[model samples]
Target: MHLPKNAHVALVDGENFVVMRNGGAPLEPKLDRSEKPDLSASNYSAGVKHQDDAGQALGRTDLEELAHGAAAAAWLNAKAVAGEIDDILVIADPKTLGEMRRHYHTELEKRLVGEIAKTLTGEPTKRIEQIIADA
Candidate 1:
């Protein structure tokens, strides 16, 4: 991927969110971790906990996972609205990516540079750099 200089890269998963900036040449990008937005303050709530018909407890973990995606989308939308983001690439687990897509703001969508649907939250920074370079 030919990320522009200083382009933002967001790596996210159900439980992790990271932001990095390309600080080197676009082709040989060097990623530096940037301070991420505090998503904990967002009013992202897990969906209904119980089945409406069966009255059985639905999977709490699943609902929490959905909230994670909502939080990410909300943060990104805020950045876009504030003109804080120039260009951005999103790297996320497939499920989270799908969830985020459903909530993407038009402004955010306009600034999107690319997206890779794979979980890389646990990968080392060097590995991530390599992956982005290869993309």
Candidate 2:
């Protein structure tokens, strides 16, 4: 099925978000997953690092990560709302569902799918189709 053009895409990445947030580039205006803020090439499930929570692996998370992730998600939300995207797909931990929801209640949904979002919540992720269907 084709998604609506200018869909709200809520892309999430705990690690990169935190890095960029702390690293200082929120106003640089680039893709959220730009390689400039990569902490390192994490051998994650997909090698797609943006979805990973920057500090979830160490049992301790920083406000920077949380804020960064939320910021990224919010950016997507704003962009989507402005008709810049077609849909919003949160790529962080489902455990952060409540946090994500609280942070970005405007988003249609937040789901845990990748290693970082998974690691944060330590829970299995639901299917994207299923999530969209539910939404």
Candidate 3:
């Protein structure tokens, strides 16, 4: 849980994604909001359907949620491929995290430092830093 200085921390959910950078010591991370990139156009599940083993409709697919996850993954892939990130910690909701995992790029995998399966997108920066430190 020791976030190196200048490491990137990404907090994401189905609808929200926030990136922050550690601006303090590794043991006492001071996360500062970096940027909020617009990712509303990466929907890859527009016409996808979900079905059970019996071929019955499982439920309606959450298109917005799917889009957000896909968008976040694409963004991370781009950053990784471009060598824009040295280290990154991903903190996301369980479902979104799974979606992202399905689309992670090899480059992104290499830059990933850690992952926490929790929804911290709406949490304040201080709270996130504390949670990561405690973890």
Candidate 3 per-residue lDDT over residues 1-135, each given as its tens digit:
988899998888888988999999898999999988888756666325432343325433565786688799899899999999988999999878978888899999998989999988888778898999998
Q: Between candidates 1 and 2, name the one with more favorable lDDT.
A: 1
TM-scores of the models, in the order given = 0.85, 0.39, 0.87
Which 10 consecutive residues of model 1 have the lowest summed lDDT? 47-56
Worst 10 residues of 3 by lDDT: 47-56
Clashes of 3: 0
lDDT of each: 0.83, 0.37, 0.84
Off by over 4 Å in 3: 45-61
Worst 10 residues of 2 by lDDT: 19-28
- Summarize candidate 2's per-residue lDDT along 1-135 as a digit string, tens digits: 222322322334455432111111222212222222223322232222334475456655545555555555455456446654434434456534334555453433332211223332222223332333334
Best by lDDT: 3
lDDT of 1 by residue, 3-71 (tens): 889999999888889999999888888999997666763434534432244432453346566678889
> Which residue pairs show backbone clashes in model 1?
1-135
Better model by TM-score: candidate 1 vs candidate 3: 3
Global Cα lDDT for candidate 3: 0.84
